[model samples]
Target: MYIINFIVSIIAIIIGINIRRNKRNYLIIGYNKLDEKERQLYNEGKPLTTASNIFIISGILLIIGGILAMRSPVPNYLTIVSWGVFILFIFGGTLYINAEYR
Candidate 1:
């Protein structure tokens, strides 16, 4: 079960990385053609285009979290860090999804 959790967490990290990559790609492409509303959002830094940044950061956090959660000989503090990373991963995902749908 513990191994499974670790694997799942790693998978989440990979997904996050992909998301972040897509967002960056869109950003680099100048966002194609932005609607007026999208332009407004971009001006306000809300840029509802892609969740790449969030995903990338979340993926990194998950990697740390997974390392901590693994049954390795790491210290207690690492375990805490792992949990923290997992939390960030969740937050990133939530924020991305919310922004995308909204």
Candidate 2:
């Protein structure tokens, strides 16, 4: 279970990295001409790229927690709860940002 959680955390980190990379690519690579609204959203999303940092940081913490759990036995329930908290935090932040910003 801990291994699975650790893998999930790694995936989360990868996702964050991908999003950050995509944002950079979008700016540097330059895409086809977008409508005004699309262009505005792209500009706005530039700021939102920082929002993905929440995922990256939380994922790192989860990875550390998983390692700790492995080295020094912790309660399984506690591990689950910790993982849930991070997931909830990421989801809630993403939703809030989307709702309020977009």
Candidate 3:
């Protein structure tokens, strides 16, 4: 699980860089669906890159937590809180991007 989480973290970081740079390949969060006008709006705003950063950070945290969980009996409270934050960030980022494009 830790290995998988680490791999995901790496992938997320790469995708985040792509998003920040506005590359079309391996685009995250349905960004490729944007039309010309929407693309302009996205470029004018920071939400797209913000969302990517959020995902990258979340993935990194998850990787760290997963590794810690391996050697010890991970505490329930910490796991729960981490998951909640992750979900909220992802949801908020998605909402921001969708609302912007819409």
Q: Which has the greatest TM-score? A: 2
Error (Å) of candidate 2 at residue 30 is 22
Instruction: Tell me which of candidates 1 and 3 scores higher on lDDT.
Output: 3
lDDT ranking of the models: 2, 3, 1
Residue 77 in candidate 3 has what lDDT?
Answer: 51
The TM-score obtained by model 3 is 0.62
The order by descending TM-score is: 2, 3, 1
Worst 10 residues of 2 by lDDT: 24-33
Q: At residue 21, what lDDT does model 1 achieve?
A: 45
Lowest-lDDT window of 10 residues in candidate 3? 23-32
Task: In model 1, state the lDDT of residue 1.
Answer: 34
lDDT per residue (tens digit) for residues 15-96 in model 3 = 7766667744234456567677765655544665666677688787777666665666765555555556667777887777
- Worst 10-residue lDDT window for candidate 1 reads 43-52
In order, what lDDT does every prediction score? Answer: 0.53, 0.67, 0.65
lDDT accuracy of residue 49 in candidate 1: 27
The number of clashing residue pairs in model 2 is 0
Clashing pairs in 3: none
